[model samples]
Target: MSGRVMPGHTSDLLTLQDAGALWAGLTADSAVPTASTILISSLGSAQMSYALLGSHVVMAVKAHDGRWSISESEVRRAAVGLRAVKVDPQDLVRIGPFGGMPKGEHSEAVLLGWRRRIVGELQRPDPPEQVVPDGDDRALHLAGIDWRRILTEQSRDRTRQTWWLPRAVVRLLDAAEHVERRWLQAGQKESKAAEGIRPRSPRSQTHTTENLQVTKPDHLAASLRPYNEELKGLLYSVLSRKPDTSRKVTGWICTLCRKVPATVLDHCHEHGYVRAPLCQSCNAQERPDHLYPNDIRVTDRYTRLLTTHATEWLRHWHRCPGCRTRTTLPLSHLAAWTAYVACRPLRPTHRDNHSSRGRKPCGTLRVAWTGSHHTPHTCQLTVTIDLCPSGEHRDLAKVPYRQATEQFRIWLAKTAPTVAAAAGPDRLDDLPAQFRPVIPDKSDKGLGLF
Candidate 1:
């Protein structure tokens, strides 16, 4: 005999773990909980009305010996109290009907009404013929008594007093109301005036006409004309002049013939044209005569010779192809060579001895004098053929004498003006003819003479 299942008993049974698992699987098909009422039997009582509310089971049950109990927690968990309380719209009533004063549209109206009532009551005199009761009934329980006295008594002890309007107060009140009405009228007038005026939109024609009046391109070009002319003048000045004056010759010599101002260009066989200028006679001639690749031997020999002279003499003197003489020496070259020879072994001691004696080296020997004409007269001539330094004795190939002569003259003119003058006026004029003019014409083209 299986026990009959009560109406909402299924939820109660679900509180058991096994029954809950079964019920959850079954209820998964429904979104809303199944609604049903049930009867529960508990504590030896019967017909208990129960409901399933969300996750809890709520019930009205009978206890042992016929007592009823309602579970508050269970009822709350079931959401029974969640329904909103409602009053019928037809039953709505105003506070005035229930003893409150009639509502006014503004606070001033309400205040004015209260003030009138209080003033009227205060102005009324007490009835003279009325019987006077001297007990609590007359003082506290008098019928139709004035409440204003009571109000005044209560207000007398208060920190703040309530204001009562007399004739003066009524004047102030009238003034305030007049000011308020005037302000409201002024605000309404301003609002109406603002609504009457309209904002104007920008005119397209005016904007387009203004844009068209912009300055013309020709005016802008005219503004820049002065700057362009100035730039042009600067460029002409820079480009018209020769870039380097060192390439200009003031004299010439023929290295191969050992002659100054030789008629033939080939006599100076060691010189060669280098860029817009020419190379030193020795450098030009020896460059092509290298016995080793890249002219390394010749370059090394020249570098050593230049170093031996302390790089000073090489700056002013060039080797001659014909006599093998180092000629066209500048005035500074004399001091430089002297310093070089003095630095050599045994030379300084010889110079010191001569200086001490107040005499020069013997006349048979010739010592190079690079000073003024008076220099050679003051010094004794002495000749000494010492072996050149090992590093400076290498052989060099011969260069074109014409090119070498031209280069040497140019070098002399720029760096050794005194030596060039001493060589004679005609000697200075004997430089390559091409260098005498500003620009080479058709006849002077491609000769490699700048």
Candidate 2:
């Protein structure tokens, strides 16, 4: 069915069925549950945020206007009326964000087809990631000294100040050569002094001026590499904690940004290769050797928000139809979507008698032992079996157990891949691909959106 625009909200539209379902749901559950979506604003932008059930807004999934204005409060406030509608937990059509029902070609076949395809994809396991070595292996403790400071101070001490001076002298009995003539050259021989006046030899006259030749410092005689190792150890001791048995000790916490754990042992290439444990952000950048604080508050906030949103989404979508076991669901987006579709009630025309009658599903197949013969030469046992969807497909029940089992096996093969691909015990990978995690990227300093 084509979408029909709502009278007041002309920009958005919904099909007749979706509109009706929404109206029913809103009117049915008017009391706000903690999981209900809410309108929040920052800097004139309007966003819709969904929180987790039974929890405050620790996590959230958000949808926002592409543009904004100073009147964003008014825009968000207008949507406050829309908040009266809480999601119908049992409605399969009520998927995705509020008001995000599928639009055209709402055929049962199409829905089922999409569901099967998504389920198959979900079952496939994600490939493992390769870890590149980024940090130093040196172990550190608290009792280390700042060897760097001592080394610089020693270099400064090796420098000293020096100077040179020139002196004049005269020898007696050496007559002045035509110089004294300017003054009266009296017959009394100008005895300069007891020693005659004489010029000092050039070699003896000159003294060394300030020595400008470059010289290396003596303390630097020892390479600071050993000290750097010790410093690395000390930093690790102060900054990083020992990981639990299951977790490995990577490196220390980032000396630069306190937000992320240090993955690499970083050094100032400009200086004497001084090293410290640092996260990818500091190590990857063209920055100074010293650690500078990284402003990760924004990342931290958004992370909590997105995590809440995605998690609740999964819980809502993956709940089992019969038992409603949401906690056991695979946390993959594909799995969640598939589970939702599989739980959807089939149309009346498509449902079998058993399903229409609301009979709780027992074992899909029933087996009856026919007889057993205990002859010496031959002993044989036979059994009758029944498969489900009772009436029209009752012929399937008459098939031999072996054949029926084989058919069931085939169905398992088709469905197993997606179901088995669910989130593993360590849910680090449980977060959806849309999120840009802080630890994964070196350049993810700014707030990221999903």
Candidate 3:
């Protein structure tokens, strides 16, 4: 009676509420219900096992493994199938996220609740900085205070300049946008409130309107002055350039991107420091080459912008080394060529290992080449080359892959200058010897000779 609680013979106890209550009473003495005490009910070939574990009743349906496993909501369904009343198990259940958090509940509050509120404040026109009315303001105030407190914890680290510069840069950018919106909204509210105030006299109505029209919240600007200063200091420290001149230009946005407020001066790396203001997004595109946090550079910020233009060119046409015809090339070849032009190393591939949760398994890179066809009727030959971090391929320095790739890409670009450039000739007589066929003919049918 104390260990496993099997349902007794009773015609009226078919409902889930009756079954749950009976199981609870029977297992009152037992902390955990065992398989021996669990009553199995069959719905066709599948069997449902109900166990009252301490205060909550847990149920498991027979899986293909011939074992019962517990899930969050399936037990309720199992109880219903056995003709029991619907018993909600949510109160007695403890639900959690996938990975365990080491910093405990406070970390969860910051990460889940506090971060979400900040994100919502940034994305929407919600007036977060304004004082809330009585009961309505309590939750918002608490959330705002918690978020600010978490950020303040990071401020001590922000005082020093080091490898954390990129993180600080990102945080500053986010804070700048949030504070700018809040300041603007506060100013707008002040202007609206000023308009609501009764004029001193009918004769002074025009004067009141004029004053209200120009009622810019200098006080709000004064209060948010630190955010503006912090943004400038962080930009100057991390990017090694002055704060974007746009900050001086009222209501400035990126001339090129048109999406975000222009925050950084986009210095043309190829054009000897010629600069223009651009949004962070456009700047990212201009310098698509991602550097490790510590490897941030001033010049590489503009490489990807050029690379994008080159890629758009490659998408339309590439001259075939074999036939000397302008044709669409594979995307992989185009990407490889772009990487070569940008002097970017190939990105490595990752394979997930579920067996070991903590360790990251080794990765591999595969390079595939499609061989030239002698005739269109014959199948084109493809060779797949696998490169791994082992033995001779361990360092990747032994192969000179980067150098060879650069040389080959340069040769192709020059040979297909018609595709890569607007001014280059369509036909080149000085192609590399290996690229030239054994014999060349004017006829299209016999383009290549053995």
**Who wins the TM-score comparison?**
3
Q: Each prediction's TM-score against the native?
A: 0.14, 0.15, 0.27
TM-score computed on alpha carbons, candidate 3: 0.27
- Measured by lDDT, the strongest candidate is 3
Writing each residue's lDDT as its tens digit, candidate 3 over 163-232 gives 1112222222333343334333443564466468853453353232223221111122333222122222
lDDT of 1 by residue, 101-138 (tens): 22221222112222334433334455889765532221
Residue-level lDDT of model 2, residues 61-135, one tens digit each, is 122433211122222222233243243322111001112222231111111212122222223344578343342
The 10-residue segment of model 1 with minimum total lDDT is 90-99
lDDT of 2 at 289: 13
Whole-model alpha-carbon lDDT for candidate 3? 0.30
On lDDT, the stronger of 2 and 3 is: 3
lDDT of 2: 0.23
